[model samples]
Target: MATYVLVAGAWHGSWCWVEVARMLEAAGHRVLTPNLLGTEAEDEPETTEPLHRWAEQIAEIVRQEVDEVVLVGHSRAGLVISEVAERVPEKIDLLVYLAAYLLQDGQTLNDWAQRAHNADAMTNAVAFHSDGTCTIKPEILEKIFCNRTSAHFIDFARARTVPEPIAAFMSPIQISHERFSSVRLGYIECLQDQAIPLDMQKAMQAPFPNVMTEKLDCDHSPFFSMPHELVSALERFRRAE
Candidate 1:
């Protein structure tokens, strides 16, 4: 059985992948939902670490596994998994992006996001603060992220989201062809995702070819809206590889 590491995006924790991890475990595969450093609600004000800290955490998790791992990143986490692949390419069996920021070397997540300006829902959805942290607009949270989720889950998600550290979003990821490009990649497109639109996802992926792809007809928050379908897509990634 393959080990799966599910990394949540900003403002979220291991809680986001609850259902996905549970389903993967039931199928006899090992699953890890690792929360980034200082991302918990209580850690909001103190969350000053950059994106690479999350990458280091995932790489350590991969080292714990006896074999290669399927690294899955959601939304903003696309950046984190990419960094992890650079650190331990051999330990990673496949790098998976679920409606995430699949940026290239020297490109910051902010650089890719600005192309949309105010057209996409994600631009104004986040409010930046002087303390180098950001907060999601509660009103727009469900709209851009969980619009397709059930009413109960929408509430479930809203209450759990915490403030995010902004340094990671602005930091340029250090990767290279000799290291980062050695790992195989996969992308799971959330066609209905408003947080990161289909066009943006395609643009981020344009630089990388021969990457495995899967599609989901759901919002950005598929973990809450389409966990079964998300698991199905992940299973497809395993089979394809």
Candidate 2:
């Protein structure tokens, strides 16, 4: 059985991966979904922790939890996994970016977002807080992140969502081909995604010529909209490796 570390994206906690983790566990694979700092609380105070702190938290979990792991990053967490791989490459067998932001070395999420075709809409939708944090308005959350998902799941997510620290988005990721690109990379694209459009996902992935790509006929929140398919895709990726 393979071990997997499922990392959630900005404004989300490990709770987002519950259904997917359960499915993976049922298939005899081990999975760990660690909540990034500040995400555990629905109303956590604006945080000062840089993006590296989030990566360190994940690296610590990787060092202590499993011998080796298939690190899966969802949404914004694509950057997080890259940073974690830099910190502990030997502990990660493969890096999976699930409709996530796959950034280049020294590129911040802001930089990537600005280059995206949907940049104007995404930027306009964000409600920035005075404390260097930001969040999507609840009214638009469903449309943006869970458009194809059921109402029940969208409601649950909205209730659990928290403010994401802006510092994390602004902090550029520090990675290198030697430390980060050595691990196998896979990308699962959500075809109907509105949060991270299909074009943007492909653009983010273009630089990584060796990355294996898979597609799902779902929206951004595949863990809720199509957990079984997501699990199947992940298993197929693992087998290919």
Q: lDDT value for candidate 2?
A: 0.89
Clashing pairs in 2: none
The per-candidate count of clashes, in order, stands at 0, 0
Superposition TM-score, candidate 1 onto the true structure: 0.95
Task: State residue 115's C-alpha deviation in candidate 1, in Å.
Answer: 0.5
Q: Which stretches of candidate 1 lie over 4 Å from their true place?
A: 44-49, 117-121
Q: Which ten residues in a row have the lowest lDDT in candidate 2?
A: 41-50
- lDDT of each model, Cα atoms only? 0.85, 0.89
Model 2, position 229, has a per-residue lDDT of 95
TM-score for all models, in order of appearance: 0.95, 0.96
Residue 7 of model 2, lDDT score:
94
Predicted candidate 1 versus true structure: per-residue lDDT over 1-241, tens digit per residue: 8889898887777998998989999999988886777777666454455687778877888988999999999978988888998899989888899999998889988888778644555767888888888888888878878879898887777898887878887888878998888888889999888788898888888889878888999999898899999999888888784
* lDDT of the structure predicted as candidate 1: 0.85
Question: What's the lDDT for residue 104 in model 1?
Answer: 87
